[model samples]
Target: MKQKKKMTSTGFLLLITIVLFFVMYAAGMVIFADKGFAKPQMFLNLFVSNAGLLVIACGLTIVMITGGIDISVGSVTALVCMVMADLMENKGASAYVAVLAALGIGLLFGIVQGYLVTYMGIQPFIVTLAGMFFGRGLTAIISTDMIAIKNKLFLKWANYRFYMPFGSTNKKGKFIPAYIPPTVVIALIVVLLCAILLKYRKFGRKLYAIGGNKQSALMMGLDVKKTMFKAYVLNGFLAGLGGFLFCLNSCAGFVEQAKGLEMDAISSAVIGGTLLSGGVGTPIGTMFGVLIKGTISSLITAQGSLSSWWVRIVLSALLCFFIVIQSVLASAKKKK
Candidate 1:
């Protein structure tokens, strides 16, 4: 019962934040949107357009909750994206083959990082930081140019949209499309898997225990090294998945893709009330948190006037604000 209440409180906090984001977004639209601040499509774009980031952020959330961080994800994702595109276009691999290749690449990278963190006793931060550099350097070596995916299967998947006709169309001549985006589907799958693992599975409970107190968990006979390794391995794998979805969405991959994504992922997890101090969080919360971050960028982009840099600046401020709130809240909880 006590745990349930805590979950409720955390959920309420998340809800309040979502409301606040909407308020800020509405204000921005009113002042900035030239067409009187009313557009239905704007709302749709929030979840659909930035869906790839949403997926990646969700994956990053899992690693953060384990009392660890992964900085290499952004660059690794870029590499996966490039690999997928290159394989499909130049190597004439089918979309399915390219996907397997991308995921396999992600798995391989995850294994390397996991081995370092768990076996070598390297700090997750340092290990992943090295990973970040290595991945980015490889991406640089691969090419700085944006490569597009012209594969027919890939193109159809990207453009596939579901439409629900509501009075023909809206003010922008856009239909009320509820079409599924591959990125959104992938994000949902991640969310569902995380939910099941964290809530209903023994491994998930073990994860929580490990994060709560690594020494205690080890003394309790939990396989600390294996769990930690899996955390990082999974993190790397998800980064790769995020990369594939990202490239699919943009139809290309560049060395600079998903830059600063680690920060964004960390921010999303923290904002969702996942403790940086370790232990306690839900993928559902993380999903909402990513949506909030994505929404901010979408609002800014919709205006088409504000510099894209504002997206980073605005998110940074919000990230700090949420971190402060979390610190205060955690301290108060401890005092109680």
Candidate 2:
């Protein structure tokens, strides 16, 4: 008789997160009933508000699965937004051109960091740290001030919304429609593509092999350097995409844009079931992780009396708890 394999730690963590989200959401609805946290719009708003973070978290999940990290993604996102804003607002460039330029910069930045990490034998942390500083410095050099985006095409896209079939009535006796932003749609597409790439592609398989054990992957004749390098490139591209979505949400850019956003992405990825030790994760799980953060923030907002910093405090605590769980899981795997 064939025995069924035990559920993996990643699977277990993902299940926990899924349950946690529903539990937290239910708790919020019970506590903030008067504030209408139970509305469908409130739920839809989670995706609409966190579309950018979704993309960023997906990118971070990919890199983490390859047993590497990119602390510079948030800075890269800021740089992308700043560059796009400057090009459109100051240089009189077309929105299309500005967006392409931002994507190109992100790709270039990723390639350089990847090259240093994979070819030059530099540590991922040190290289990404340098990349982070460089990105932030370039952003400031462009302009320390916030630059509002006034491009007609960009504005049109930002304002475009797709309303859901169902809606809720506000306390004012008016029908409030639920809709998702174009950015949310874009983020969803990216997530789907990433999910496919990671689950069904040869490159994705190699990444898992490498992350599971570099020596074994090398023995199996995988192109470790090339795969790792391409992983960073993909991460960079996604970061750029995330920056564009974030700009759509904010309609402005500044040097401080997306500050500490890397932490958010990382924490989200971790919470989503991506192991820091690598070789275990899913994009779908990361999406849920992003939603969890959005839900927390929404709950805090509904409370009204809570400090905004409460979100950060709660997130940090959750991050710590997840990391501890990962550590325990790793230890168990080693023992087995």
Candidate number with greatest TM-score: 2
Over 1-336, each residue of candidate 1 has an lDDT whose tens digit, in order, gives 233364644565577666776787678677767643455555555667666666666666667767877788877888888888778887899999988887887788889988988899889889888888988888777777777889999998888765534323567986654455667777788888978988899878887888889999999999988987887778777777877777777888678877887777777777776777677777777776776787777667767889989988888898888778777666666776
| Residues 1-336 of candidate 2: C-alpha lDDT, one tens digit per residue | 111357777788999899999999999999998777888988888998899999989988888998999899889989999998999999999999988988898788889998999999888989999999999999999998999999999999899989888899877988878899899899999999999999999998888898899999999999999999999999988988898898889888899888888888888999999988888888999999998999889999988899988988898899899999988878777776
Report the alpha-carbon TM-score of model 1 versus the true structure.
0.89
The TM-score values for the models, in the order shown, are 0.89, 0.96
Which residue pairs overlap in candidate 2's backbone? none
lDDT of 2 at 183: 94
Candidate 2 residue 334 Cα shift, in angstroms, is 1.7
Task: Give the Cα-based TM-score of candidate 2 against the true structure.
Answer: 0.96
Model 1's lDDT to the true fold?
Answer: 0.76
